[model samples]
Target: MSTTPDRRILIAEAALDLIAREGLRALTHRAVDRDLDLPAGSSSYYFRSRGALLDAAVRRLAQNSRDAFTRSGLEAPERTDDVDASARAVATTLDEMLLRRRRDLLVRYALAVDPTIDPELHALLATGLFSRDAATTLMAAHRSTQPATAAADFVGLVEGLVADRLIGARSRDGIRAGTADSVEQLARSIAVFLRGLPTESTGTRPI
Candidate 1:
């Protein structure tokens, strides 16, 4: 009588761990099988092809990233309907979402780091979800003043910050008590800039 492992759980979790710890480039059906201490062909049983496994993994990564954004973004606004307040919220949300998602964001970053992925996948990587959200927040707060052109600018700000942090231009505070302080400061600066602009149409609630 031999004990067999629950193959599905073993593979799915191993795929995620591989992506999280190493990167998408390092993931392969055979490698995942090895990582899980299972015999070869187990991964192929669950996911028929490499494309299938990557498809599943990318979908999981998208949902996880979106959820992280919503968790921090959807909180009750500390200053509702005010330009400064909304900007603060966006900035705070950006840092909180990025920092809170240590492994997921890092994995996403790592995936894009390699230039060998499918071109379509790389295109998806370039899309900026946070920028759109930030613009919506800022324009909703002060549409009457500067005009609602925040879509590009706001996204640029968050993207720049994330890039800076990842590349060392931004200060390192994550995993420390000072992380909150740095994020809070970023929130204030963004709020100040956004408040000065004219608002756009009221933004929609997250779908």
Candidate 2:
């Protein structure tokens, strides 16, 4: 019942872990309290309602993602100019998510498809691990004719790649694919995608 920041974060993280391990239906205030081994009504005291708890979990997910990105050096401006470096940076980040932070990604995907989730929260999870704005900047640095469109395509491709590794038929192989293999494979794909983009000199075509 105490209003400590750490307790709120603990509740939210417990909720995310519950969703990842047991699915969204298992995520109740009492369930979160049980997961955290907190006193009865502890989670509810902080979150007040199911929706609030879900919001806190989503926010925690986003915060964790942003922290990971920052740690991956994706925010470095110098890397954008070099497509291969950018690709590797992104690939490394993806590898981290797919392996170390798999639970967070699973929780994100689970929440994404649930209609009961808030529209704003839905928007928050829509971007997946990387934002379109970051992709747009990368595309612009690569001299894409239409950076926004290129960014959309890039984000979509990355999303599919991650999803395939996480839940698609490739899931088994992806799990066996270690960090070196995963990062190399993803970096290659990203490099090829960046290279295939229509550049400014190629000129834009009618949409």
Candidate 3:
């Protein structure tokens, strides 16, 4: 199938949508073509096998994750002096991800639980493009001597909270109020967690 760069991205995004809404079983080349209203063999032309298509979709979602972080102004903070400000930035970023980019997060979470996607997911996370790496970088920016350890702890905390919310652990209110409350709670938790960290190798000055 003759394809352009744009069409490949579109097909990958369609795969993500299918997985997010209909489940991974529904992520077929034909299903993607049908969803996109493309020619019969279009998706197959670009991705000959199911694994190939899934890989493409996973990569696309990774790129989307990076884009979202950048858009939320959490890509990289210039200073680590103000932990509260940093925490708020992180909370705002999570609010954006949970509210505006929920579908992408769902796709990521779905892939996380799928053993078939484990290799691909591991590769993606290792690339410094997703959460673990992002969190590591964030900690390093704050001059944590053991950035990896801190990042792991912080990411685990946040991911657990998010997964709990996503899996119907709590009832959600209307979007605005829910998002605000979630962000506030995240910010507070993040600040508190950071404060609990050892201060020896951290650049985070005491407030």
Candidate 4:
């Protein structure tokens, strides 16, 4: 507790834990307070309304997601390369990330079905952070591609692929199959796209 300087992140993490263990319906102020070992007014102090709290929760989840992205080596130059080398590095990385994100997907799926989940959550789910826009922008920068539409398609492809794997793993069936060729397919798709581009590639993988 002494080491945690950011209470917002702490509160956000607590909320995530609650969602992970219970469900999105469990993300009330009372639940956050209980999870954080705080007094009754603690949650209200930080978030005066339910909307505020839920917004904070979404923001926190977003921050955590960005942190996880960088830490999972997605931002590393070696991993961000445009060729098969980077592809391999990232495939290995996403394999691990896919496993972790499976838990988040399960929690999110529970929220999606629950009528009590916040509207903000529904909004976020509708336009996810890994959306086609974000993915396109990022993939473009990563691959040095200029066509926004094409870049976004690759981004969408990656997002859809990752979501597919995560959803399957999160299913109650508990089967976590699909890999290797999946990565190869994605890499091949991105590579073919990049190869067709007018820009002289930096010898990187397409997506």
Candidate 5:
């Protein structure tokens, strides 16, 4: 191939789509080339190795997630006092991801469970938009007494909610209910969780 950032990104994206549609076992340089309709060996020329291809895919996934967060305005400075708005913003972002970018999420889940994946790649997959650092920033902005712990819990809750809609028992129900219902329910759940956290103003123990 072409020596361009766009070309590399295109290849990586094709790899991710292949993984999402056919599972990790179907990911290969030849498969990616076939998916993109590129000549044989094109993917290999750029990626060089399976490990390098996986790394590129992981990086692409992270970039896509960050772009989604930025587009949703969630990456903006925290509002501090607007818990409801923040909750809704997060819910909206999640809803968009589920509806418009489900393939990315599916690929993420596939990589997350593969034992052969590199530790660094696994960590990159885990560090999503609602990562511990981002959650901690939100918690701190809200004046939570224990920002670190609260952030951990918040991230866990968000992950659980996403998983529920993706693979858990509620997956079918969430799908049938559609985007509007999912956003409303997710916003409500996030708002409740945020409000329940013990903040400096509340002077209550961490929950």
Candidate 6:
């Protein structure tokens, strides 16, 4: 690496890629160095310890997630008045996430499950809120009587679907093959939930 700040960021990103594809066992200084075609000891030189390297990867993942959501126009709702539109918009974002950001998601789950082994992983996941606030806001705009609860439910629904698909895809049979259709089904389910909710004038906004 060039020893610039950008180099550190790039190294961190490579660490994320390593974890995303090959699990945490693959995230070593030498592995990252080799993956990025850098000189031996380059990764350890930049991030002195394994914990430091993991922290950097978490930060990079957070930034990448924010950028992805912003680019997909899911950070904010476009047509708040139309519940169906919001559902489709949110569904589109979920689809993009599963299709393009699967690696990040895998890394996230690994960190979540390995927190006991690496306590820093817990703090790292805590710092990165996972866009829950945005989901709440979008649900609120759709006029949910309990936007916070509804948003939580909707987000949980999508998460379950993605997790299942990811697991199934890696199985021997590869039984789950339809990403677009899954996202559409999720969107339709969310729309149905939103449309069923009775509109209310006042409610506590999600924090």
TM-score top scorer:
5
Q: How accurate is candidate 3 locally (lDDT)?
A: 0.76
By lDDT, is 2 or 3 better? Answer: 2
Model 6: lDDT equals: 0.73
Candidate RMSDs in Å, in order, are: 6.1, 3.3, 3.1, 5.3, 2.5, 4.3
Evaluated at residue 111, the lDDT of candidate 2 is 89
lDDT of model 6 at position 78: 50
lDDT per model vs. reference: 0.61, 0.83, 0.76, 0.60, 0.83, 0.73
Q: Per-residue lDDT for 31-68 in model 1, tens only? A: 89899887888789878988777755665666665766
Of 3 and 6, the candidate ranking higher by lDDT: 3
Query: Across residues 1-207, which tens digit of lDDT does each residue of candidate 3 receive?
Result: 555888999999999899999999889988999999998999998899998898888889889877776787666656375788888888777766677777877877777767776675657834423477778777776767677999889888777656656665443633342466778877888888766665445444455
Q: Which regions of candidate 4 fall more than 4 Å away from where they truly are?
A: 1-5, 76-82, 107-128, 131-147, 169-207
Q: Supply the global lDDT for candidate 1.
A: 0.61
Ranking by lDDT: 5, 2, 3, 6, 1, 4
- TM-score of predicted model 5? 0.91
The best candidate in terms of lDDT: 5
lDDT of 2 by residue, 1-207 (tens): 655998888888899999999999998998888878888998898899998999999999999988887787766454234677778878888887887888998999998999888899998898647788888877877778888999899989999888988899778773443468888977888888876876686564212
lDDT of 6 by residue, 38-99 (tens): 89999898899987898899888888878887797777665366766777776777667767
Residue 6 of model 4, lDDT score: 75
In order of appearance, the predictions have TM-scores of 0.71, 0.90, 0.84, 0.64, 0.91, 0.81
lDDT for 165 (candidate 2): 88
Residue pairs with colliding backbones in model 6 are none
Candidate 4 per-residue lDDT over residues 1-207, each given as its tens digit: 454447766777777677778876677888899878899878777788867776776666666566666675555352143556545554555555565665655555565566766777776754444445544444555555464766566666556656666664433444353467545644565455545554426544333
Cα lDDT over the full model 5: 0.83
